[model samples]
Target chain A: MIKRNIFRRTILISLFIILFSASTFIGILDIKLIDLLKLDREAWHNFLYFRIPRSVSIVLASAGLAVAGIIMQAISQNKFISPTTSGTISATQLGMLVALLLFPMGSSFVKFGFAFISALIFSIFLMVILNKIKIKNIIYLPLIGMMYGSIISSITSVLAGMFGKLQTVQSWNVGSFTLLVKGRYELLYIIFIPVLLAYIYATKFSIVGMGEDFSKNLGINYKSVILLGLVLVSIISSLTYIIVGPLPFLGLIIPNIITLIYGDNLKKSMIDIIFLSAIYILICDILARTIRYPYEIPISFVAGVFGSLIFIIILFGRVKYGSK
Target chain B: MAQNKKLQTGIISLAIIVIICYMLIKLIGVRSLFALKMIVKVRFPKLLALTVSGVLVTSASLVFQSIVNNRILTPSMLGFDAIYIAIQTIIIFLLGSVNFLLNPIYNFILSTGLMIIVTLIMYRLVLQKSKNNVVILLLIGLILTTFLNNMVTFLQSIMSPDEYLNLSAGISISLTNMNLDLVLIALPIMITCIVLFYCDAKRLEIISLGEDNAINLGLSYNKEVIKHLIYIAISMAIATALVGPLSFLGLIVVNLTREIFKTNNYKILIIFSGLLAIIFLLLGITILEIVGHITTLPVIINLIGGIYLFYIVIKENKI
Candidate 1:
């Protein structure tokens, strides 16, 4: 069993690295590896500054979001309750809007702060509401979560309209990695901390996900683990929104497909899940960039289209397999 | 209800009249005749569109709840709005700005036809089996809507800026600004649909009583289900295609009417909820008018209605 798990882990990481390199080579500006080896200054600068940052940011964002999703689904014990469905993305957008309105000249870090705070607040609010509700129907949680997101998003749009910032918000809503170059992308590295933290606390999150009673019996502090999950989700999500953009449904789908293939072992499957999410997002990004060559489409567009379709398949897959 | 029928009818008739008169006076203010003519020319079709669209949306939603037997579901949840947006995006992408904007009649027919066909296919597939699993169907609809919307957004990203500019005016859900010409043309069709809804009210109430009950009452449950799907598809397509999509107006109007009027009668529910929709819509338009063009009413309605929906769902869980 140990040997097989190691083999799978190695394969996943290798696949991710290979795709990451491939995505770097497909943008509008071509920078060949052969040119870099020949000590070409332009190739080196473009690759090091533009291609590498964008590709690394993609992997980081998706992996972070995927792990965050696992923790969320585990804690809530609902596959549908990802950051996107639970209003985290919308809350970040609201924060981004407020950051734009109040601190128009502030650095991206300021915006990140606003986004992180609001995202944390919104998810906690959702948690409180979910705690009070009886889970007679599993599907109802995600449905309510979506309604919560829409309410916040509509409010964001209304505010944006009043402030004449609708166009600005629209640009961000496109959710692409087109703008991530060297200096602008350092903030994304902050995502690594939450991801590391998730791994450190994976067992607790899994126990918490089982149920409050199960968690308390195992001597884990249920509320604090729940808070840690929210904070991890918020940090990863908000940072991603600031650095990249709001890539819808990635958080929901990646962990779902991962858990499906690998089972619900957070400690065992977390690394594999991270690697698979990176590969999935890298593939999507590569397709979007090439589909309309010389003019890249946003990643969210491709992800949303395919993500929803995959979600439908999974919905049926669950029924057929009766996995739960 | 038998005892209160006269009182309910009298109150409903009065409320409808009061709302209409108030909206008309608001539209045709006592300004100069030229200004009145200009205002009437612009706002009259909008008022007609809003009123009829309100009735259409609410009634379609009422029938939709019956057909699915779920109170919280809205047609928009099935992504009807996303489909409309996708249709507009595809039109602009394929035909350019001139062909799309120049032929409003063709656009109406094409848009409404496409929406109806799409919804019909979905309803048939979803309702055939798994009758007990409505949430899965709702999830599928919601997911498909997201997929369609993302496709539209991707297409629009690659569109010529001018063509996208044309789509912007047509696609976004706005109550303040509309193609009055299309509204005028669609008025007759919308009125006929309202009449058809009134005609089918009793049958719809029976069908809502679960499939076994509906079947046992000498109603061909399958036939009634098909008819329900057809009327819902046409009305919803026309209404959404006429304006943009109203995500929660139907939910608020239908549920509020059910709560306040204390009526299980589908006949009274149609008119009662229709009036509630009109009042809600007119109030929205007038407020937008008063605030004067900084924001659209649909987004605000979405905000209010979504909060109300969350409240209802939370309350359900509490019980």
Candidate 2:
């Protein structure tokens, strides 16, 4: 039965792969079919070269975000929480604001560094608060996260308003792939790879999630593990926000989708989430570029709409099943 | 004993609201209130609108809480703000600067009405199946909000720069420079909703216990919820359309009401919550106006509300 299930899953996976490939092919065709097909080889090469970096950035950013979200939900033990939902995204935005207004001439690396450090600091504070406050019920935690997120967001909003940069701030906060190019995309890869490695090596993360007491009994340093998790999450998330801007529910939705299909197994879900996020973003990117002809809908909007629909469905299903 | 405590809190909250409103009127740099022309034309009417806005936000929040059976969810979750942004962006994109300056009311009504309709449709669609799950409803609402938000952003990016700037200026919620006419118009509807809510106050409590429980107790749960939902929808439409999305103000006020009154009865909670909301809203506006002399008081409220929510969460967790 297990083998059969695996086979079925593999087949489904293959189908999604086909869909992604076909979509990519069509997307490429749509972009260049008119002029490139009629032009010489050099033009085709130029188009391909130009598109490659942006496509890679979109795929990596989406997958990393999805994986990070899955890890967060697993550690936090709540599907509703995301970097965006938990003020982590806002903290990153705050970092960007400081970088922009305070250190206007700072390099992207320096700005991202500031974002990483600030987000880490903020997220650590949240972890400490969470640790000190014994959560008797789970539902309230998300509310706290939401509130924290709003506070950070409001601060950004107020600052933006005062500085007459609300629109610029909002556009960045909204998260779009429009600005993705060869230069900025590298940063996402750099932050993503190391954090991904650290996450894998941290066996205590899984044990800690089992329960603090259980981990302590098993000689796992729960606080350190959690702090480490927070740091890892902060760095990766901050970097992604810096490069791709804010993806709204990019983190929350894909992870939840994976868990619904694959159950609570973290390792499997992690892989599923990565692949699923890639496919989801690819399709969204394709649609974004395709739907309006010369103009593109921001990928954020596509993800938001599709992600919300899926989230609602999952929530309804979960509620119908009467389980937390 | 409980009733007396609620009544006392209610009275205190009301007094605070009045004081804050008076202070806000003064702080808006509206001196020479004794002058009949300015007072009637600007000062008095502005005060009335702020007062009414506070009542509308609180009562609407209360009714929303009753129907959803959760204090956490608000109508903004249904994408009213998102739709508002979408409409505003589209209007500015299409009309340009001259047309907007030409007819502000036409723009307001058209955009606001479109938002209401779209949000209503989204709410009705997702809310139908998962009426029992508050979390589900909230999740869907957030998703819809994000979708609409994304759509607006996408449109704005492609829109002409002048159009984008024009829409952005108009979109931010502020009570500082509200047109007296708009406030006057919004006031009657706000009061009417409150009156209607007062009449249904008893049923709201029953509905709050969830539809199954309410139905078991021989109440028409669906009917009760439907009515309350409509009230919430209208109230949210007015509040958000009047002023852009004030995320944590309602959350802070509604939660504060629960904390202060320490009761679940709709009549007491709703009434007190309205008063508390007004006080908080005015207090927020006052502090921002007095200290920063800033236009973006809503941001300050959002920050304070966020902190208050965190405090409540920690406190609740402790228990």
Model 1 misplaced regions, further than 4 Å = A28-30, B1-14, B17-21, B24-40, B124-133, B155-165, B173-181, B211-223
Q: Model 1 clash pairs?
A: none
Any idea what lDDT model 2 has? 0.70
Q: List the residue pairs that clash in candidate 2.
A: none
Q: Pick the candidate with the highest TM-score.
A: 1
Candidate 1: docking tier: medium
lDDT of 1 by residue, A1-324 (tens): 788878888898888889988998987787788998899999998889999899999999999989888888998899988887888989999998999899999899899899999999999999998888776567767877887888998899889989977656766767789889999888899989999999999988888989999989999999999999999999999999888886778878888887887788898789888888899999999998889898787899889978887887788777666532
RMSD to true structure for each model, in Å: 2.8, 4.2
Please tell me the interface RMSD, in Å, for model 1: 2.3
lDDT (Cα, 0-100) at A158 in candidate 2: 78
TM-score on alpha carbons, each prediction? 0.92, 0.86
Docking class of 2: acceptable
Give the winner by lDDT.
1
lDDT by residue for model 2 (A1-324), tens:
678657856875886677554543454334554566687686566455546566677777777777667656756767777787777887988888888898878988988888888898887777767766765446556656765766787888777777877667767755667666456577777756744664574456556768788989999887777777777788778888888776667788777766677676665556566767777888777887789866777777777777766766666667777754
